[model samples]
Target chain A: MKLDRRAFLGTATAATATLAAPAVMGSARPHVVVIGGGSGGATAARYIASGAEGAIDVTLIEPSRMYYTCYFSNLYMGGFWDFDNLGHDYGNVALLGVNIIHDWAIGVDRDAKTVTLASGPSLSYDKLVVAPGIDFVDDAVPGWDVSKQSLMPHAYKSGTQAQLLKHQIENMREGGTYCMVAPPNPYRCPPGPYERISMVAHVLSERNPTAKILIVDPKENFSKQGLFEEGWARHYPGMVERIGPDFGGDRVEVRPDDMEVIIDGQTQNVDVCNVIPAQKAGKIAELAGLTNDAGWAPVMPADMRSRMDEDVFVLGDASHQGAMPKSGFSANSQATVVANVIRGELTGSRIFPARYSNTCWSLIATNDGVKVGAAYEPGEDQIESVSSFISQTGEDAELRRQTYEESIGWYNGIVDDIFG
Target chain B: MPKLTFSSILLAGALLAPAGVFAQATPIGDAEAGAQVYQRECASCHQIGEGALHRIGPHLNRIFDRRAGSYEEFRYSEALSRQGRDGLRWDLARLHAYIENPRALVSGTRMAYRGLRDEKRRADLIAYIRAYSDQPQNIPEASPTALRAEVELSEETLAIEGDAEFGAFLSAECTTCHQRSGDHAGIPGIVGWPQEDFVVAMHAYKQELRPHAVMQSVAQRLDEEEIAALAAYFENLGN
Candidate 1:
């Protein structure tokens, strides 16, 4: 019989009492209720359930029957990975004995340690993990809000809107204008709008080379600015342009049907408008009263638990605990932290803390991809990047091939981390 | 699985008690189950020689007792590197803690790997990472040449001076699409180009014309003066 001393200690202690020493188990495993089966929530559910099998009851509550990734949908707009590659079934999670409930978490009674769902069902948990993804802040942009999403089509959240943007692009004849307005600081996928422009340009170059892609940006420059611009030019020449706030692109206005995007003092009519409206946490956060004045939840970094409530943990695109953009990679990374902390807290064990990593891949064109990646460690209160890298300026055959290849690998890896 | 006689196991530890045995006995993790975890979560990010492939993160060759976040090429988050440089190594106990919540341990890190809070999963992931313990450090793997193009272009910038003709040639095609003065999607107006900034930009483009299919051909035709003229042209447009 071989017995490791480390295992010996764990079993000896665990034998006497469940990890939750104070909270007695109901004859089964300790209940771990997870909200939002997106990147963070899904990853947490998979890891926790798989790791502790019978030791924990992992329940995941998600609104959507099928989850759609905001990542790579740009490529979908450009016709890259099919919906299958990006779409994930939660069966893998179900195989791990995790109760995957397709429902939305509407209310959280922190005092009672209860979660009320939209369907009038309630679940209690010894520990809770929340990874509800981003919420678009409609009020941030005047004259532009959720009601206007139908017209403007931010396409930031992905799904049907992503298809709608494609429809808009295909509908526009050559020589027509296509405009995209970017949000200010602290937005999801900072390099996203640029990638969308590049992809749209790629599509335009194929369908209508004479067509144009105009970017009305809030910032002077965007993430991986050099690489994106280079890719845009090499792949789709004369199809794209960028304007900034200082140059009259600030607080831009758009009329969807008429096809107009205005910045500063000037207004212009065009064929299509894709404005990525300001973003916050998803509606669930606001509904639960977890959002602050800025429309994002602030949390204690130790466990990514919201300041608004202790029993509840808010993560992914919703929380403002770390200094990182709201991307699939970052959200997936954040899920790891939240899952670990909840596991430790439930078991009364000391939690191991580590750094976070965010590597976002943006496709400038079909095979031309640029990546903005960074390695970050949690700061005193924020997550700060230590080293960052982006795609090179020129499109050498070797780099182009590698970037393209890596983009696929990145996609597959992220998908597995969540639904796989 | 053979049933282990309890007293004999205890006696074995007592009899073979080696000095400096500080190994903490933790819960049992089925290595077989851990192996699945290894393949799913770990093998993606870590490279354990043949079985492990290189992920965006690091190769976990001989990762145990390895300093925390001390990979040279991987360029760790300042926070992790600082701690590793501070003399922390990945012992089992520490490994468990880090796998759970990396941020709670080290701030300013970018591992993005959510800690495997499930002790069993942590054990499995650890087992997977530890499988490379005997292997040597896989150091300084050169980046594929294509990945370095951005680095090369980064060295050459668009150097501008006060010249409208060069700016006009530089931005000639620009005005055809971009409003030389308005803001909107996909169009960056070339109004008020800073002289020095314009000069640098043209030189960059003239070198390759701007790292794209269109810009490369466009900048190739322009002489250095044409680039400057374009810089000056845009500089004077708004001013």
Candidate 2:
């Protein structure tokens, strides 16, 4: 590794002197630039820095100083966890030798291997990890746009939008209806919309018993559908109703000004409307030309290297690998794989087989939690599921409680793993 | 840099044991093979290393001769606790039977594993578990006929001509929740699998041999050819 570093430095210095490059300073250590500090980017930055043992320099570019995880934001809405608990700072990640920069990455000059930040000097990297998460397709939902977001909050990104949605639910009129316009298929968190509904129902069942929750879903079947349905029937039976694609869930429009949701030919006035629009890879990925026709960067199943550019690796919600959900756990798992690959490439470290796993736990009621999980391996075209398990519908109260507790434990463990 | 301690090196050697063929009691089964079985089947919920804390299940250090549900730190299920009261220790026979089918042995054991139906694999797993015990027990050799039966069953499951391209198209439904790219929170990523292993596993799920309902349904949907294609597709995905 040391020998490679010296050789790389000698070549880099010669190139820099000849090219007069503005981005790189001919440093002896290899630089790794990570864009987006959410689950994927933060974990990748931290791991690359630590795994290389000071052999590589890592810089993380994120617009937000504090990252609020989308994983447990539903729990926050249900009052299970405080809002502050969802926010994580990069103090620990910085301690791991990552240079944390609070700025949005505007563009990627792939030819020059440089990343242009919104407000800073451009940084050059020997390797780059783009994990900018998701960005909504602005016009996917008719009559719904960012300006009208205040009236119909998505709360999917887990920040102020989440807080706004929580406020709307809490301040909703008694006996009023709260409707959610769920996103299309292939979005982040497969079971997120139903989980949000369950959490909202949990709050309404207690505080506003007369209040109703309506779900306008584009997909007919969802993740943990049986479990969610059973839990809803058991806990908040009459309070929630989901309208699938058969019931005009696909042809829905929200009138933010009138606070009305139009499904097919019928329209109903609602006190609160959460419109989660269709989504794609984060904007930075598109700007970098890493995204494919599907708006997600294609990656090799083994190491997550971008199909378009080998020097760049895409992780988490931005990459199209296979068989893994776009969840924080999945991103963190991918980060470990990418970190290992980056370390091996730069520092001559050993790269292990990419064995990935994820478990999504959704809390239906206070202590009623259901989980779906599996162990996976790399396949020919994408990641594939090797084995899987899920909580049974008729599980006892003790088991449900334990499952919820396990989710809490996992949340803490993953946040620590990623941020630290 | 700190110098490597003699004990630390020995510990490392033990952990790095590729075949886990420890020089303890007369080796009945391959400890290394058993270790792999343990990793794939039990490591998720159970721990066996030094200072391993009880997770979903109790740590299994020195588990031989220990009464069922005897770990003080872990809260055992009622069935396991009752068996512990009855003075049932995890001896070779008990471990083999229990691991082969926990619910069958205890009736209400909370361990989520469906059980290892392969007789040889069960023997190997028991042998691995024995290696972790203070008083290692000798595993009785399996009869040639029994081993042959298990091998035949495994071979039958792997007899399929897989097409990778067709498998990729069929994988769309699987990737809906399984995730083709990115982090897998609770879902496992299945890429780069050996074709034979993939086929056998899918057959297990399709035949209602695995405990997971979703996988069972998924496997039931895929015909033998489709399953073979999926196996071929995933098998070629290598690191």
Candidate 3:
């Protein structure tokens, strides 16, 4: 039950015929090129290379040498986690015989099975994995874009945005308002926006109790709504106010230049505005012609193969995953399945059944943590949840503390698993 | 139900004599009729007689007065595990509720059966299961053995040798949170345990005996050989 080198060499030669990539053709093993070195792509590359054991050549293309995870960015915002702990390098990933290319993957030629990098190199691949997390939809919010991120600061993506948002929160006026225009449904980390709100409330309650927190949310409900509400009432009473869609939250506009939020044509001055607009798959997936009408790449239920292209797979937040939230845990779980399937196809390894699970732990205030998780299996058309659980609202302090501690452990374990 | 045995009278006497000072006396339901209920509902997943091996579920020997999900050899659901860790014991009252509706007792339990709804049948089933368990009141004398059928397993149960190569492939799921360098800062290190211990622990998780949602989900998906393979791979890592 093994695929020999000749079969891989035959496909490799055919896939690279149009390109002048000698390294790929000369190599005896198959090549797997993964784009975006976040949780999905990094774990995929590491697993394939390690599982193949020299039988396959894996290359990972990511723009940043050090990846700062979005999972714990909220913790950093709340001053619970150090910023340095959120970053991980690909040194150990490179040590595992994976070709680490710190370059942006500009384009993918599905016809030629080649990935064109921004630094002027086109690498051919037998299989391509696209894990470019997400990009904000164009003009989803009026007067909001990545360029004005310095002013409004989406802080949605990893790295500098978080730092910028934190700086703004710290230096805000004593009684100034901190407004967050939360995104709609199908966004990465369903509990993320609420968690961010909790973090912001935490910082404000401690520093400026008089300062107000305004949540201009588009949706009527959010992840762990009950638990977050309970914690807010108990810990930061009279500090947080959420305006759902009923009060014109959906029809909102932000003027970054004037530093004002217009909710249903009524303008309100705010000190800091965190605009998390509607999101879509990263631009590269759309460029690769893998995205659908919904701004996400539809993937096969079994292995996350892009429905548009067989050779290409879309993982993580970019993927329109059913019954699985777009989170780092979900992405990492999917990446392992992708790696196993890719290895089985290219190197003739044993392919196990795809099993996916995700657990999101959000810290409400200090040691008050809540979690929701589910086990998923591939159904006929989409991934279906088999079992699930969510933390109760009235949980005791000890369990909450343990949940928070477990999250830290999980963070360490996932980063180690991804990078190494 | 069969006529009350001589020990039942003595047990009833013991419970009634202390009622003025302690809790009320409840009949230890009919064991003979309960044996039928066990055959119909519980036998498919659980085993209770002598030499009962860990099958789909853990052997139910010595279940009374035992901590919930505490059998090291069996895998219990994370829900059950947490309840056990939260000081839940398999007392008569708790057992009745669990048998009546498992999910009501533990939300994420993996026990697939819809539960025995009949109160009398449930009580009978509990009585049947209780026969194999330790009785604190009967500590001086050996507890009576059940008249149920025995389970004889081959000497070479789980005898399949783990292939380290396959284990290496499987270790991808584990190493995500557990460092390969075995630096257990927040998560416990999984490297370098005895293969047998590893196998047993994984089985406990697979059986859902161990707590932790992610671990239970991950372990439940793995087959017996894969567990062995992972055990062998993790045991030999960095050596």
Candidate 4:
């Protein structure tokens, strides 16, 4: 409810940034503070800073030393992709005259309307856009704790844990256990666990065909469920098994070690377990007091501004997107929405959001890909999809080729948006 | 000061200001330079020069004066095509604005390229399209614009009627690349295109169907049903 000095300073900085900008475009534009220079943040920064050159200002804030995309993280872990392929740099944001600040958020003072970075500096905004992406609720499970993350690394957000999962996949011998506990419904990248298994099974089958990959799930259905399960049955049968919560498979009381997963009334021994424990907004969201009891911030449709904070807008995995699972693409699209809204606010214009699109591609196998996508728009108070698409069913050789080509194309394309 | 001297000074100032603001209309690059760039960048999907064909997007032969979404075939995203289905012509000014930075000009479009931002580059590109266009020569002269406008004046005489001749004036940009051939590559020629499919596709793209980043970029600029008029016009053209 009240902002500290840093938060106050951030707000003051925004005002200064706003006022300092010439009302008229004499080549210098209004500056926009885009927190989380990921897909959404970077695109907004690039467009406003460059496209509207002499008309807008753009500053990007991201904490990652390097951007490791979740899009192809599964491939990277499966040994099919190199880490560098998924990594992106912020130089493009910088090239466009966008201020790229590599720092995390410590607090957001709604009253003063400022964001206090972990670096202790503050940034004010003509408008503030938060595409901070998703956060893991390390303690989402009743008995689980953050210190025990080593035992169950979600590896979902990419970067360090991504490498952790990759190393485990490499070292584990044949007949070892690969337990990946899926989250309840509405998590980022719904088809992720299924796709991860497919990718792992493909790699493991060739190296260690005897390895059993068990998926512990909390939901009966998933994104493109029919398509994913179909691929498993056709290619790697019995090697990849999913434990349905209703069918005597417990979600997870606790995983004391990477070697075991407890389900129903038994302890299943595991070799390398990847428990994608449930997620909410990142820690900064909680620190900024943006979450409701569910650990998500509610916002008006399309613009993604928190209903509680008008000057503040949230996008990506951080916002409660309802059925829209958090993925970089979704995050990026939401970023476009919020960025457009911020621009409109800065320039005094009306918002015209006819639609927004999200397409998530999962590398089910080394050379194969599966996808589930949807296009959304502002419904009354929230955004909803108007049309959805899925990767064609039954791996036609052509479909498979298209999938791989599309995946590569998408990666290059999105990378272009992020850093190009 | 003499009255003549003051008057002369005022006239000189007026002439210099616009010269100062507009700077110089770009001439270093003609539509020829624009043609080369378009061939290198946009020709893969968009038809830009003489006898243009769409690889992915619609032809841009005479796009200068066409309405935003008035094309009959080569389904445009509902977003951009919707803008002129109601007869909103793509005048030089609007075309330049859209070509500069599509997403800024229209949100919710699927066109992925950030748009060519250099004003001179854009003007040169448009000029190139104007310079290289090879539109239909046999279509007889008819007042498509007036018929459509007169229908609008009546409002009830013909439900959403447009002058085939006048609509053709607006349709020049569209027809150049449309059915210039029965079907070119993957794009269907407009000769026998079904208006329903054409309209629906525009709506879909406007609404985000066939969501290509580039299409999304352009579609977001158009509105609904402007899509319909373009569809109606195309549908009337002998299947």
Judged by lDDT, which candidate is best?
3
Tens-place lDDT per residue, model 2, B1-239, is 12322233335445644434433323335566878998999999888866777899888877877878877778888767655643456665556656766754555578888878887788767667655665322222222101211112245446767876566545534544454442344434567756765675666556543334555656765677888988887767544
lDDT of 1 at B135: 22
Best by DockQ: 3
Per-model interface RMSD values are: 21.1, 11.2, 2.6, 12.7
- Residue-by-residue lDDT tens digits, candidate 3, A59-117: 88888989999999999999999999889999999878788877788999898777887
Q: Compute the lDDT of residue B39 as modeled in candidate 1.
A: 76
Ranking of models by lDDT:
3, 2, 1, 4
Count of backbone collisions within predicted model 4: 50
Query: Candidate 1's residue-wise lDDT over B59-139, tens digit each?
Result: 776676676776666777755654564345665555655566555344446878776767667665655454445423211
How well does model 2 score by local distance difference test?
A: 0.77
Residue clash pairs of candidate 3: A413-B176, A413-B177, B75-B204, B75-B207, B75-B208, B75-B209, B76-B207, B76-B208, B76-B209, B77-B208
DockQ of each: 0.01, 0.05, 0.30, 0.02
Better of 1 and 3 by TM-score: 3
Model 1 C-alpha lDDT per residue in residues A16-135, reported as the tens digit of each score? 242222122333346778888887788778767665545677888887878888888888888776866657778877877787777778887666555777766566666777778776
Residue A269 C-alpha lDDT in model 4: 78
**What's the lDDT for all of these models?**
0.64, 0.77, 0.81, 0.61
Please give, for residues A254-356, the per-residue lDDT of candidate 4 as tens digits.
Answer: 5655366678757777788787777787666667676788778777776677776777777777788555667777776666556556666766544444345
- Report residue A88 deviation for candidate 2 (angstroms): 0.9
